[model samples]
Target chain A: MQIKSLNDCNVVQMEEKLDALTSDEVEKALMGLIDNGAKRIVCVFELTEYISSAGLRVLLVVAKKLKKMGGELVLCSLKPLVYKVLDMAGFISIFKIFGSEEEALKSPQEK
Target chain B: MVQGVKISLFGNLILFLVKATALPFVNSLAILSDLGISCVALAISIILYYSIKLADKPADPFHNYGYSKVENVCEAMEGVVLIGIILAISVQAAMNFIHPKHTNMPWVGFICSIISVVINFIGAFYILGLAKKSSSPAIHAEGLHYRLEGFISLAIGISFIISIILRLNGLNKIDAFVDPVATLLVSFMLIFPSFNLARSAFFKLLDASIEESSKMEVIKLLGKYSHKYCDFRDLKSRSAGRKKFVELKLILPEDIPFKEGHALAIALEKDISRNISESEIMIKVEPCGKDCHYIQKNQRCPYL
Candidate 1:
């Protein structure tokens, strides 16, 4: 897990595998960033090889938190398996997603 | 490609010489097995040099898809060679098991094995880097082979040292069995990469689909234009060598003009190309629902 702040957005890059074992850590880290007054969050899933429902739950929680703050939680560079999991869970309709970090950063902020 | 093969060939030759030199002095089955595999490696490297050259040939009249399969063929051949080496090692190990001979000059064999392992490690690293950069399966397969061989050499060297130490402690019978046991262990380890190379090459030869992730990427790209089109359907994709072939069928509203549909397809292709640069895309736009008369033919129709 790595976080890099760019301009007004915080980019969180997930490591190789994100299952039940690592989901709690992911949730804590994202919550830590949100608690620090970070509004715009972009979770990069390029390096993530696998992500189970637990990981998705963490993303959903972060998304809800950002939505409450009138900010946005965007996802970018999701590997196929993760994308399918999200799509299957109907989270694709709930969250804003982009193909790359640049595109996610350029997206309009939620009001 | 030629440079990569040449480097691998020279490296394998040197490793082979090192192992072969130590084989006669040590009288160890493990060293013999290592020497035999290296001999096969030297032969395969020569074949790989030609295969790489042949695989680089552009698409011609006879071969429409170019010579990419030559790389796959070479990879499969390497796998077969490794299997043969395994078989030979197994037979020798069995023979040694029945009538074991204690290894002589164990320290010299250990030193040579270490040197070869180091050389192979460096060679595999360099070749794998080149393979990734060029996306050449032949070079990649060769690199995998060398990486496995290096580990085997290291194992053989360690076994030699262990056997020598045991011999010094007067455990002569145990020392006698060490060479064959080491050979068997290394030979079994060789199966994994050999099987992997063969399986991958076989699939590529049969024209397998591109990875699921890449296919999903195409679908995700099309999702951005969901509102513009009635629906996107029948997205198919396959891969050959480094090239990806994508066929996308999009259902458009009947009211949309043909020019607009074509423009949408072109734009979508551009977007997809941005993500998958090696993709060759074909987009077919059709009227939505019952407006598509071809739907009655019981063909692949999303709006049935």
Candidate 2:
């Protein structure tokens, strides 16, 4: 996982296979960004191929935390399989998704 | 659990033989009650050992849910046998009141009772520990029976010693009542646990739900993903002997792919099972109907 600042939001580049063993690290890293005062976060899932319920649980938790603190979380560059998972779980509507990093960063009304 | 039951079976057999051999010669209600409890324990331990083995059999065409309930039935029968033995002791105790007499060589009965008490207690505690590790109800029931038998034997031994001392001091009348009174007291002490075991088994026979703490764990796990789905319906849980069952229906957004919904269900099922050992779980998923607010608004689902 890698975190970098871009414009007003911090982008978290996720790893492949967000399952039981890796969900905790992904959660902690994303939550760490909020702890470090980064708001308006975007998670780029270009490298992630598979996800488990634990992974989805981490995302749900982080999103809710950010929402409660008057911040937002968005996603971009989701691989097809990962997008299908989010969509199939009915989580797509709850999160804002974009086709590219530049589009997510440029769109102010996505949230 | 298997080792615990094995120890209980052999231990009860040894105690029963010792008391049975002494009963005809001792002529004391104290000795009789000791032998009676041993007989009951031996019978129950044999049943428990086999029930543990039978309960491990997997589900087959003849039995859809497997043999787990055999342990519960065996447990209930054990309680029934204990009650039967207690009643027998009570009858014999009442008989002794009418014809009370000092026991013949009560010192022999005391020594034998003391030895059996020590052995029963050791075997009881050992089996209880094994039950905890294996989580077998049959072994737990056997352990408890052994412990109770140990206490009864202790009471029997103490009464015999009291009789011995009284006969030596020429207090014949009091010694005559000692054995009967001790039998009465021990029988009274055993009633609650016997009835308790029977009651617990009755509930299990009806397929009662899992424990409250385990149900809470299921609820807490679902709460973590509650926001992801539209609704959950028909949640239910039950237990049979050592087996726990949890089942529910989950409703998700209409556009969620069937396999994705299944994945979520499997995840939650596995999580809930992990919380409660020896559990079976089933989660069925249904897509939300057109009555949901999203469908009512006539808005195209953005994800779709």
Summing lDDT over every window of 10 consecutive residues in candidate 1 chain B, give the lowest-scoring window: B295-304
Ten residues in sequence with the least summed lDDT for candidate 2 chain B: B295-304
Q: What is candidate 2's lDDT per residue for B32-122, written digit by digit as tens?
A: 7777777777888888878888888899999998999998898889888888988998998898899887788888888888888899899
Task: Itemize residue pairs with steric clashes in candidate 2.
Answer: none
Tens digits of per-residue lDDT for model 1 on B187-244? 8999888888888888877877666556556655654555465555555676666567
- Give the number of the best model, judged by TM-score: 2
Candidate 1 ranges with C-alpha deviation above 4 Å: A1-111, B289-304
TM-score of 1: 0.69
Question: What does candidate 2 score on TM?
Answer: 0.71
TM-score of model 1 (first chain only):
0.96
Worst 10 residues of 2 chain A by lDDT: A61-70
Each prediction's whole-model lDDT (CA): 0.80, 0.80
